[model samples]
Target chain A: MDEFSFINSIKQHSYKQSSLIKGIGDDAAVIRQPTQDIVCAVDTLVEGVHFSRQTMEPWHIGYRALAANVSDLAAMGASPAFYLVSIVIPKTWSSGEINQIYVGMKQLATKFRMDLIGGDTVSGQELSVSITVIGYVERNKARYRSLAKEGDKVFVTGTLGDSQAGFHILTNPGYYTDEVYYKERHQQPLPRVDFASKTENISRIVFNDISDGIANEANEIAEASKVSLILYEKQLPIKDSYEQFPPKLQHKWKLFGGEDFELLGTVSNKDWNELQIIAKETNTPLKEIGYVDDSQSNIGQVFLHENKQTYRLQKKGYTHLK
Target chain B: MDEFSFINSIKQHSYKQSSLIKGIGDDAAVIRQPTQDIVCAVDTLVEGVHFSRQTMEPWHIGYRALAANVSDLAAMGASPAFYLVSIVIPKTWSSGEINQIYVGMKQLATKFRMDLIGGDTVSGQELSVSITVIGYVERNKARYRSLAKEGDKVFVTGTLGDSQAGFHILTNPGYYTDEVYYKERHQQPLPRVDFASKTENISRIVFNDISDGIANEANEIAEASKVSLILYEKQLPIKDSYEQFPPKLQHKWKLFGGEDFELLGTVSNKDWNELQIIAKETNTPLKEIGYVDDSQSNIGQVFLHENKQTYRLQKKGYTHLK
Candidate 1:
């Protein structure tokens, strides 16, 4: 299909939202702001760097792209509203393949109730999907990474390391034949939008999505908030399926693996109990793996407690830039 | 520089706006909506497709990317506000080169008072810059392509075909030594945001940016509004610099060349005189080249009047999807 036909095919998938005045078929999309503040985030996924065509389906690529941007909004405690996607694809791809990609995007958009308002598609040497999501939040209710305070507990939603293990399985095909769950985790990450809404009423809570591993994001919060993070390895919430791997690999993946799309945040000690109850009510797996502390010498330092031995945790994660 | 350092280097360039609650260095950027409605547009530029490194400077590429998206908002008569950029570059590029690209973006952003709020940078085989601009417009004042009425006078701002000629000169160096104006026009087409603002008070006006040439965009306006557009070829806004080229080349570029980034729209005969006065005060060269007519038999058709002869104008332009 040509550009116009491809746009027409996917345009039907865009749903009408009360705030959206115009979507697609226009020079720019028009949307009414439901609240005072709007949250915006952008993320790009490249063909080989973010995903390989040999290991993943086109639909999964599309789903993952939108999921990553939605994860950013989830981190900000914003309600998903609209998304603009810029897709660069090779000319050799079939129209069916392109439609499948949009199918994946439409499925996720419907689940999140987001309007695919505006975007552009162009021919390129490789496939790259870049998405920018816009959402609305009350001025005072929006969460930020710089709100963590000393003595606040660092919490994460859902199990960790599954996405990394999934990546390994996808790359080394026959190596983990029984780890279908890991592969699925990597390909289809559920953005924790529902969980974020449950904690919207709680004040002074800081949140960020774990797109670049817990260690990397932990350092970001620590530096931004002028605090230090101390993580206990024993408290890391590793999934039961992850136990099948060797302990060393499990530890590596749990601490440094990215693309989990789970929410990593901090809540004041006073609200910890209340948050736990809410998490349980919402069916969100909340785990306390670390705590914030005043920096003594090394500001923004991260400490790892493993087997009762404390060591400095290096800031490292899945980085596409060398 | 590492990803963090690279982000930090550009972060300082983000100017503070009162409506911007948060800018960069977080999971997402937050902005307070100053108006009831927001306009959003996204466009992507790829190396060797939209530009080439040998023919264009890195800064020009970055400037062009944002300019294209800004043009969309101008067409909708929206005030330029915030933008999110996603850049995918080869790992071989230097930090200085990347900084130059941001420098180009910053120059334009500063001129328009637009905030470079949030984006992601990733590694890819080739360079691609995708930008999504968010602007504000009052609900009643926003223009649409579907609002053209029969007998409305069609108008355009500034000269057309300059960008295409600039592209030619840049690619074919030394061919037009004195035509530096065309080269600059192509590399940095100014978005007609100020002109759009000047005509905000005009009622029943339809607007679109001449990015894909007048013929192509005219066809869109005709089909969208269920009308026919008849253009007098002698009224086509070809710059004096464009005369140096052969007549055939000049005619082709003026009619079919894209990326001029000028506004094209229609206003009722009553508002045309007032619009001309406003355009002059704003230093915008507004020209009437055509008129919208009731679609009697050939609905959504465009006709060209040239050399005492008239014929149907084909709907075609510079499409990257070929």
Candidate 2:
């Protein structure tokens, strides 16, 4: 269809929210936020960079793009409220494929209660999607990486390395035939927005989602908070299928692989019981695998402990990893 | 540089604002808006569709991308507050070019008192930039395209078609050897945010930015407000150089050439004097171009009166325009 008709169709299908005074179809979407503080994060996924059209369905691409933005909000301890999508379509795509992309975004947006407020559509040589998510948190309640304190325990929600494993399986199907679980994990990784809310009551906490793996996330917190992070390798929660992979591959995927979309955070020692209670209440799988140390205060570092041996985990991949 | 270092560098150089509680380093940027109503607009400019690296400088590409989004907020009578940039970088570009892009965006942001809150960086095959801008409009003060009144006087802020002419001159450089005004107009079109606020106090006004030329913009108001818009060809604003073009070319450029980045609106006839006062106070170039007629109520249409003959302006394109 024409650009005007495409925009009009999007406007008609927009989900309404109480805060959204005006949705699509205007020069800009108007929203009267209920809370004073709002958090915004944007993510752009290109066709060849993040996903290939040949391997990924249009629906999955849409879901994954918005999911990445949602995961950022979840990492900041915010509730999803509104979002905008800008998509560039190539001439090769069919209109039906475009519809499926929106359907995918709609499903995730509906689940998170985020209204699709505005978007831009353009014709280009390659496909790309950029989504910006706006969310709300109470005044002074939004979590930050610099909030991680000494004696705080590092915890994570959900299993790690599964997404990378799934991606690897998809890329090398001949080697790992019949690995539906891995493929699904790569395509349909869930954002932990609900889990983030459950931990709101606990104080002295810091969160960073595992979009770029724990090595990077933990280091970010360590550097920002001026503390060292000591993670126990054996304590990491991995899927049952993780044992089938080589030892190095498992460590590489769990520690440095990207796109897990799970929350990795540190909380005060006293708040650990409180976090556990909320975890039980929310039915979220929570695991404590590390602790914050302030011994080396001038600079921060992340140390990985495995079988009584400890080594510095640089932001870059490990020597063994590459 | 690596992605982590790139993000860290961006975080260090972020513009600080009181409302921005957290900036680029975190998962999301937190903002506490001044006004109750927030207006959001997103625009994406693709490599080949909206611009080309060969024709447009890196600075202008970045400036133009953000300007388009800023204009949307201006049309809604909102003050620009914050923006997030998500850009896809191709292997063909060097780090210096990307730096120039951000420098270009920073120039506009500084001029308008906007903060660079957050952004995403990714590697891709094609270069594209998607910018989402957030602005605040006072409660019930935001202008809408669907608010045109029957006895309203249609107004515009700046001259039109300069951008199209500039683009044409650039593409056909040998034809317009000494023309620099048109080229500057194309590359550095200003967002009329200040001009939009002047009409804020005038009640019952409808606005649409002249990004896609006056024809498309005025038609949007006509369709939204369900009123007939009658324009006189004699009242059309054109540059002194416009007389040099062929009659058909002049009409096409002014009406449908696109990317003018000016404000087009209809205000109550009673408030025309007050708008004139605002025009004098703000030193804005405001002009009365047309009138809104309620004769065509159920569905709206736009008509142009030229040489004592009236012809309807279709949204698609004019027969005479082609």
For each candidate, the alpha-carbon lDDT, in order, equals: 0.77, 0.77
Judged by DockQ cut-offs, the docking class of candidate 2 is incorrect
Candidate 2 local lDDT, A45-137, one digit each (tens):
888778986667999988888898888888877878766778888888876787678778877877876666567778787888999888776
**DockQ of predictions, in order shown:** 0.21, 0.21
Error in Å for residue B25 of model 2: 33
Model 1 Cα lDDT, one tens digit per residue, A1-322? 3323433432424332344443443212334455545677788999889888876798998888899888888887777776777888787776567666767886787787776656777879988999988776665676777788889999999999989889888777675644878888898888988888677778888888888788877887887777888888889897866887878888788888878999888999999998899888979899999899986775777788776677777667322211
Please list the residue runs of candidate 1 whose C-alpha ends up more than 4 Å from where it truly belongs after superposition: A1-34, A174-178, A317-322, B1-35, B175-178, B317-322
The candidates' interface RMSDs, in order, read 15.7, 15.6
Which residue pairs clash in candidate 1? none
How big a share of the true inter-chain contacts is recovered in candidate 2? 0.41
Model 1 C-alpha lDDT per residue in residues B210-252, reported as the tens digit of each score: 8778888888788778898888989987776678887888888
